[model samples]
Target: MVADAPMTPVDIEPLPRLARLAWDRAPALCASRDGCADYHRSWSMLRLVRAGGKPPAGWRFFHAEIARAAARGARRVLISGGADAGLLAIVASGFRNAGVVPRITFVDRCATPVMQNRLLGAELGLDLRAETADLREFRADGMDLVIAHSFLVFFETAERARVVANWAESLAPGGALLMSSALADEGPGALWRPASADDIPARKARLQAQARGAGLTPAEAAELADVAGRVWATRPSDRTGGLTEAELRGHFRAAGLAVERIACKPRADAPALGAARQRRRAEIVARAPG
Candidate 1:
């Protein structure tokens, strides 16, 4: 993973309990807001990392990919922990109204937004269910398609490994799991926690190590480092902050997923709400058999 050379490495210490609880209070705040969710849902992720590069083109790109899978006899698609549901909506619409339909399901931790999505789906007459539980519970077993859209980076280091392990275990052989995440210029499992220069590099490295213990070789580790670079560049104005490249790469390797394609860009609409500047990605990782 690409990282800044530490001028001097010092022993790191844990945060105070009160301070730690408040560690990501801001991200939680952002997640709770409507405007923020809307902006991010509109491909704001493309704005970061790809200022001059191509925009995400939205989940239409993913829909086309899924269509290809259906043509090849794939069935059942699962999207885990996708809070915004924009991508889920597109996928569900395509499957329900379009010829290349797959059974669509969605899982999220909270149901407030998900319930709203379910109502919207009802109005559209699409059969999409949003469950209030960890994504790990969703099973696309023996199903033709599985998708983890912008889902992997939601947790901390150990959580990424567990997330991958669960997803991997759930996969059916020859049933491809479509996994996507907006990597920072750093690593894959990065969430935009407000970080100080003094704190980020070390914590990032530790997480990277945790990822390594989970899987990725050193070389592969560095390769995954490019996820958030586009985001950092695309939205220089973002107060939420950018990712360190090392952090992005380290997480992918840890998850046992390789970088299949890394297309850097911003959305044409210049949106920045749900989780803007999403680093475009498509990765196919080896799933261990049961």
Candidate 2:
């Protein structure tokens, strides 16, 4: 979830007509629907409402992020899950401006991205393509960038690892994998969970794993247990290990990508709880073999 939006996804009435029209023309979504509190949060949810969230008054921040990526020579970046074409277009535009003209390979379970990419590609004459292939089998070794913001967090523990491992394979050895998530293992410790939350099981699993990795037995794992906030915590996560700092490092160790850094601010209202207050996860950059 985004910092601005409420922790939970409570449905709010959509914005007015003029508001939506004005929003559609801009870049990113200010909220999930339009005017509640789900401010620009995950690269995923934000992508769903990109055309329906941003007011004409803003879009620079959205443009800037894409521009920076294009400037770095991301000529042909891949948006793993095609559902975020709006988000991909945001970056594609930047790549176009840089004269690189990106080709977004929208990979998803359905043809939504295929349809969207076809339209956008036709309009911009971009080399966009949509694929229904499984991530493990999809090819992507020469791409400049690969992204899967929140989609991977939906996988089970073992599946998540396999997905990341496959992502590692798809990458051209040194290409980058920029994933966004709500989980993190960097914190003083967690205190209480919101009445509507269910991260304890995942927390226990990871803490247990950590203790085991730290030379603890099952009994010891139970003894040295605590919440380290959420890792790649976008809900429906079994454990944040394959995505959190610890997980990122662990995956990188096996994948060859050295994580650069993570970004987020812990919860402010109840920060005194000493919980890890952060939103954005980390961006892991790897070097592809030439």
Model 2 over residues 1-290: C-alpha lDDT tens digits?
11232211112212232223222322342233322122112222222222233322112333444456667766667777644245455555455445556666767543434444455556556677776566655667677677665666656656666767777777664566665555544555443345334656765566567556644467645633431223223434444332456665666667666665455444434335334433343333444444
The digit string of per-residue lDDT tens for model 1 on 1-290 reads: 21233111001111122112222232353356333332232222222212222222345555555666666666666666654444455565445334654566666665443554465456556556666666545444555556666555555655655666566555565555565555454334443433342353454454345435545456433322232222233342143334333554465456554444444454334336356334434333333332
Top lDDT: which candidate number?
Answer: 2
lDDT of 1 at 285: 32
Show where candidate 1 strays beyond 4 Å: 1-57, 96-98, 136-140, 186-262, 266-290
User: Highest TM-score: which candidate?
Assistant: 2
lDDT for 72 in candidate 2 is 71
Global lDDT for candidate 1?
0.46
